[model samples]
Target: MMVSRRETLRLAALGTAAILASHPVAASAASKVRIGVLRFGTVSWELDTLKEHKFDATNGIDLEVVYFAGEDATNVAILAGAIDMIVTDWLWVSRQRSDGGDLTLAPYSTAVGAIMVKEASLIRTIADLKGKKIGVAGGALDKSWLLIQALARRDHGLDLPATSDVVFAAPPLISEKAIQGELDAVLNFWHFCARLEANGFRRLIGAEDAEKALGASGPVSALGYVFHDKWANENPDAVRGFLKASAQAKDLLARSDEEWLRLAPIVRAEGKELAKLRDRYREGIPRRPVAEEAADAGRLYRVLAVIGGEKLVGSTPEMAPGTFWQEPPK
Candidate 1:
């Protein structure tokens, strides 16, 4: 079989192209981004939706959603570069940024937490919380606790520790103890608060109300996607891709009740619990970046400073300039 030189060259080029197409290294590299998430975290819902919908794949993001038992573990992973990003609050981002850590945040959920009381309880207001046994989730350093402390100082002129018998406990235990009549009220995370509401507790004051009481005009982006600045600077497109997919997931949950119903089982919310979650998600969807929520960020900083004093996040009474990553890499 005699082959012409031109034909041999054509066949050789075709073979090379086929090999390149099949070779893993020669194929387009998929962007890998490891994200840390907690089991019961609401951002997990978005991640679940992203996975179920294949939004990450469609958006050209190879997301590795890593699970963590708690924020401390998650923070440790992030600091060690074992994970790239996590759903965390701006308060943490501010603290890290102020301390010269290379971390930044973009809004994930603006979900506001609440203080819930038993329906039959006589605690009608924050002032009435005086001397009552209260369960506080995430301990005395919890963001909600700090906000409540600020709220009390600003509106009622009473310190939270001086007013209430605060007990630091996990959220589920707080709910259980509240139901068993051991605690007068429970201040917990948003998801826990929603579950408590489903179980018949009433919100004494919501995060938004607390912010308002503290004279904040904008809705605080309480929770956001946090990542190391170095990684983000290196992989801008991947970060933007993640945000795009997440925004789509957030919008889907807000725009369609069907999406909520679909994700109910995965998120462990059923019936009334699911309904409450839908309402809360609708309310908490952040329409803009954290940079746009300046007033609320300032409010959060003030609250953190008030309750945590100089120990929590230093004496900086303002949101750190680079704390919120506003512009995505072009």
Candidate 2:
């Protein structure tokens, strides 16, 4: 269920207190890093894996993960100082920095989303979407929605909002609606898109393609671990510890299918579900920077400026300096 904004703020204020009360540490104990996460998101998966392997203990940090219901709630918790870090998009990081806030992002996943339609649907191109009831997985301000608008303007000389009927809902509901023929197409997160595709939906386009059209040299990782710059500077070792553990977890998944088998229950993978999960994970695992990747962050800045406008990306269409945490703590 979606958390009410007020309830989210309440949780933000009380979450860490609740955790510390239940799991007390000495005043001079190891550094504790409180992270905000969605209860069912991929970050949650990583946290579970970290706990299962006791990676935090091994890395010498007392990590406390607080669960939020959605991205907005997580953002609120981070800004409220209830959590030191969160798994969120670089776009949000850009917004925060533009506001004189000191948040920075680190790479997490390069899982770009897709627009899906039924196997038998007649919508073969962006132009075909005119007057169709499309289901958007995130809010009206979602990146995917902006990308779609950008695509429409560039490719078909059409404004998506004026040309098509858009309905916003959660990814699961969007997928369900598509399956029931209630929606002509759904623009959803990559994993959900993969799941729907595995269930016989067809992909019309993906955000990677949209990025390319917007002049990105290649696909860019959007979601990342975001933290307050001051907090990160003060807790360099803890920051390094978290990254080390996260890299280890990613490496484990990349190296061993057995790891997925072990996590099958948590991921709820079975048969085709297992195959889709494996495909999505492998597709998203970060790699060494390619030449094309160098242009993505900047291109993303421009794309958001043009498509998302000032409301979503802030006053400047340019990416702020130091938006990314370049030097991993030594």
Model number with the top lDDT: 2
Total residue pair clashes for candidate 1? 0
lDDT of 1 by residue, 161-200 (tens): 9778889888889889988989988888888898888988
Residue 44 in candidate 2 has what lDDT?
72
lDDT of each model, Cα atoms only?
0.76, 0.77
Candidate 2 clash pair list: none
Query: In TM-score terms, which candidate is top?
Result: 2
Report RMSD (Å) for each prediction in the order shown.
13.2, 3.5
lDDT of 2 by residue, 1-330 (tens): 223334545666766465445545433333787888988887676677787787887887888888877777677767766577898877777766766778888788888788899899999998899999999987887887788788889889988788789998988898899899998988998888888878988889988788878887666776888998888877788888888788888877777787778888878767787778777877886674632343587776787787767667767779876677776525
- How high is each candidate's TM-score? 0.86, 0.87
| Candidate 2 residue spans exceeding 4 A from truth | 1-31, 290-295, 328-330
* Full-model lDDT, candidate 1: 0.76
